[model samples]
Target: MVTAAIGGERPVRDIVPGDHLCLTFADDAEQRPVVTEYLSAGLSRGERVLCFVDRTTPGIVLDWLASTGVDTGAALLGGRLRLVPAADSYLASGRFDAAAMVGTVRREVDASLAEGFSGLRICGEMSWAVRESVGTAELARYEREVDAVFAGRPVSAVCQYDARLFGPDQLEVLDGCHRGSVEPPPLRGHDSLRLVPAGRAGRRRLRVIGTVDDRTHDHFVAALDAVLHRPGDVVLDLSALDFIDVAGLRALANAAARLGGHRRMRLAHPAPVLCEVVRLLGWDRTPGLVLLPEGDVA
Candidate 1:
């Protein structure tokens, strides 16, 4: 039930342990926000993150991350964040050796788990491979072979390729080698679902932002399903939600019915409109549901 950030605030549940994904970007500017948000999600979930920087320097990466509100200094000093130069990591012997690099990453994942971290999240810049003229055949072989590295390990990685540098054929091969690809940026003015880790114990919070309606209830249902699958209590935060349609309300009511008998689901900070609807429908009296007030606004 692990999730990762794909389109900034949007969560992608397809990402899980032992998974490798492909991220194709037109430029660093386009990729910066996605990477920062993705890494921030890992840090918040107490996962160790390793980034291979080739398009930019480690200091620049840290600065960019800080601009996104991540405590870059704290994460780096605490050893939770590891920034490795792309050349040093992918070309340790002054050449691109996929087998060696895979081995190195496997060792790092092991060390991260041994250090008491939940899991490891890795990002590698593949522009260097293209610039270095790492033979297409060799690169393709490397991409295919690397998938085996995550067979049973608690590791998740994204191989970033510059779409402008790679051709259609090569990109197709790369795409096929990955378990999944980073989705396109979500359209503006749409709803977003964020999975926030609740600090108290191993609990989790699903924060719904923007409006949820028939057009977006699928996202809501997916988020709820992800949280409900985990053991223990869950919280749904609607403090930032502006609107919800009847379909969205029905989705929540159905989720409440699926909660474990002993476990409860807390709906916090609902909007004034939602509060009124809940009261009119007597949804507040539903078993396994706790609707909190004070989030209602006139």
Candidate 2:
């Protein structure tokens, strides 16, 4: 199995050969280190690394890698690293063809394995799409095709998008397409949340982080609802979650009531705050909901 690190830590072992990851980063400076770390990790594990550079030129990227103490020269010389222009990758034949790009990606994966690499790791800078008028519909179709191409292949991909360039609607489409997303580290003592998509099965697993209050209620609801739409059970791992406001609590109750009978929801490793809220609301008896103790968390 292939594993990719989210936010420099949090190794997600659930990543299989055909998994596609979506990444939204603040800027090239903030994302360079993370990307370097990811590529470096793959190289260490004997995986072929393919990087598509758009906003950042090859020289700049190579310099960043060198700064990270990675032997970019040796990696290139060894045929373990393949760096190409992002526009070239996305605009093959002077047009963006989702089917063609997906086929090319699959071929690359197969070629990598045939060349003696254990697997293939791909990171594409998606800024080209934004500048080239790649419509939301087109990009979404491309993402879905990429996901399909990954199935049962020794290929792991991270498609990068700029948070500043893409609007919320486009970003949401991007997020919904990938199996998982790479999140940055949480603030030291601030309130925040991170959702990590588990797998492609009907079941969806999310790892919640930090606090959930009125400030984050909308996002919390959106995240929860996103998972509920999946085929089977929805598992919310709340072990790292610190707090939940009344609104957040109501969101959970609403989800439980809405999913009653038709679907199931699992609350794993509920913190003290969550446990108390559920108890106070008598949500322990909520239908179609299961609360697993910390030790029994799935």
Best by lDDT: 2
lDDT of 1 at 106: 70
lDDT of 1 at 144: 76
> Which ten-residue region of model 2 has the weakest summed lDDT?
4-13
RMSD, every candidate, angstroms = 15.7, 10.7
The candidate scoring highest on TM-score is 2
* Local distance difference test, each candidate: 0.71, 0.72
Error of 2 at 216 (Å): 23
Error of 2 at 67 (Å): 2.3
Local lDDT at 177 for model 1: 71
Off by over 4 Å in 2: 2-16, 187-298
lDDT, candidate 1, 40-133, per-residue tens:
7788889999999987678877887788788988999999999999778889989989889878877887789899998888988888987888
Q: Taking the tens digit of each residue's C-alpha lDDT, what string does model 2 give over 138-257? A: 999988887877767778887877765776557777777887676542222224776654432122256788788867777788877754544445677777777888788778878877
CA displacement after TM-score superposition, residue 206 of candidate 1 (Å): 29
TM-score, cand. 1:
0.58
